[model samples]
Target chain A: MADAKERKILVAVDDGLESLYALSWSLHNLVSQTSNDTIILIYAKPPRTVNTSPDGYLFSPDMMASVDKCRNDLASSIIEKAKKICREQGDKEVKVEVIIESGDPRDVICQAADKIHADVLVMGSHGYGLIKRAFLGSVSNHCAQNVKCPVLIVKKPKSSSSATGTK
Target chain B: MADAKERKILVAVDDGLESLYALSWSLHNLVSQTSNDTIILIYAKPPRTVNTSPDGYLFSPDMMASVDKCRNDLASSIIEKAKKICREQGDKEVKVEVIIESGDPRDVICQAADKIHADVLVMGSHGYGLIKRAFLGSVSNHCAQNVKCPVLIVKKPKSSSSATGTK
Candidate 1:
């Protein structure tokens, strides 16, 4: 079945350079792998906390609307930027689906992949140092362990030090 | 350098079924990718602790000898098993080098890759769950983030129950 062609490839994106590399790589490679492949660009939105009263109810309709508007705006901006990159790479013909879900980053990515029956999950590794990683383990690592499909973690090219040097 | 025939591909062994799959896949794919690629089997030996006085000085030369023996035994056993796997796969011509180093797994693996100028690093994703991962992230993640070369993380195919039922 290796040659059957993966129909769906999921690209999990965070505000990271490596994730962008993964997106670019997916735009280039997925088309070669399968014409029917769909690129699902997923962004995990962090949940907003609303202070609750003793009655255990929180957030009025107006406040909820404002929060929803902010979320939609953020999601749309990310999607637009990703689309621009895809266009620049000249893979506009490849189907791209932008998905924004609220929850833990790793959980949302894995759940979305399963829900979409993704054959491959493409992502970038935010290579944190040993101390940082020991305290706050990376999301990419968590997803790789939990996801069902193969995870292609595109590393930031060494020469592209300008992009990944800070993180 | 992309087309340069990979002379050596290092596979880290950690006594996991997923690792076996990764090893098998690497053997098949790397050999197909290049005609004369070698497989280097590396096993990282954990550090040994010598008995120390209350003031944190070494106990004695005999204690140091015991620690060295323990490290050697651990490394040799893993190397022996890896060599056996290579032989069973009929890769005598591939020139396997079984290396053993006493240090962190990620550090040792990266050092081995650099020392040999390995073209690729291959390992398996153990599919640890959220709680376990939160406690201790997998080694595959650490290697992927820290290593300079390309890393291929092969995920274990999920059982039907977990695949179909869980998020």
Candidate 2:
């Protein structure tokens, strides 16, 4: 087999099963063993919340530090899980890179794809209702329109097989 | 190089350059030479118009037949172009399938993907303004949400390089 061009595929993942499914699908389908493709795992950490709560309670510095620590730990664990998926799926060792950014996931993912000059950005869609999607503003849709590289949006199959037909 | 599992990739094409660019990109990047993948080219032909025009003028059968003929011709040409791209890109011969359907593109594309049981659906994004997108309701976004298989939205870069950054 002839060697194929190496690609840098940036996969935006979170704790959601949808994104994890996308990550595994990419490994099985997109990445060719002959090609030296690098898988970049990115987790967009939601920014730290305001010190004051909605109930008018103020948080102490120690409390804020603990919250930050918890967020960071979660990010690390997510990255580790994604790395394991990449490692276990393909027998050959593939290069793995991780990016944990704190900001709107929409913005962070697009920036990371551009900054790394990724050949493609693979992400998962939440597949929410129109009203909910309007409020949440579909991150996958946003990235697909804004990103420079091709964006692959993988939708997890619905629990009921019948839901697949109706949009 | 190990042989990869063959994939049936369904690419939705139109007369626009954006879709053609996506077709070419897929041929170059997505298909592995070692795998016996088949590229399915789908063209969603717009449904025929009513016999009467908006001016309340009743049209003859000849006029309606001519209009349908034109639409069919356009669809044929588009499919031919996509097939040529698939043929000329790689060194080996890859299987190509064509499907020409008449209906709303969003529905037609999604239905075709599911019917074929495609592993991935590749299409292009027009990347119009938000107001325009709101009015037209982006077809790519609809397919991403509804299709059972993964959807790859390939965005054609703007003529001006500066437009790449700001969403």
The candidate that achieves the highest DockQ relative to the unseen native structure: 2
Looking at model 2 chain B, report the run of 10 residues with the lowest lDDT sum: B158-167
Candidate 1 regions with alpha-carbon error over 4 angstroms = A1-4, A25-36, A51-67, A87-94, A127-137, A155-167, B1-10, B24-104, B114-120, B126-138, B158-167
C-alpha local distance difference test of each model: 0.64, 0.79
Model 2, span A1-167: residue lDDT tens:
13656789899988777787788778767777677889999999887758887898988888888999999998998898888888877545778999889987888999999999998999888733345458769989889989999999987776633212111
Candidate 1, residues A106-139, lDDT tens digits: the string is: 7788899888888668787773334544664777
Report chain A TM-scores, every model.
0.74, 0.86
Q: Candidate 2, residue B146: CA error in Å?
A: 0.7
Candidate 2 per-residue C-alpha lDDT over B89-110 given as tens digits, one digit per residue, 9 for 90 to 100: 6546789989998987888898
Q: Which fraction of the native contacts appears in each prediction?
A: 0.30, 0.57
Clashes of each: 0, 0
Least lDDT summed over 10 consecutive residues: which range in candidate 1 chain A? A28-37
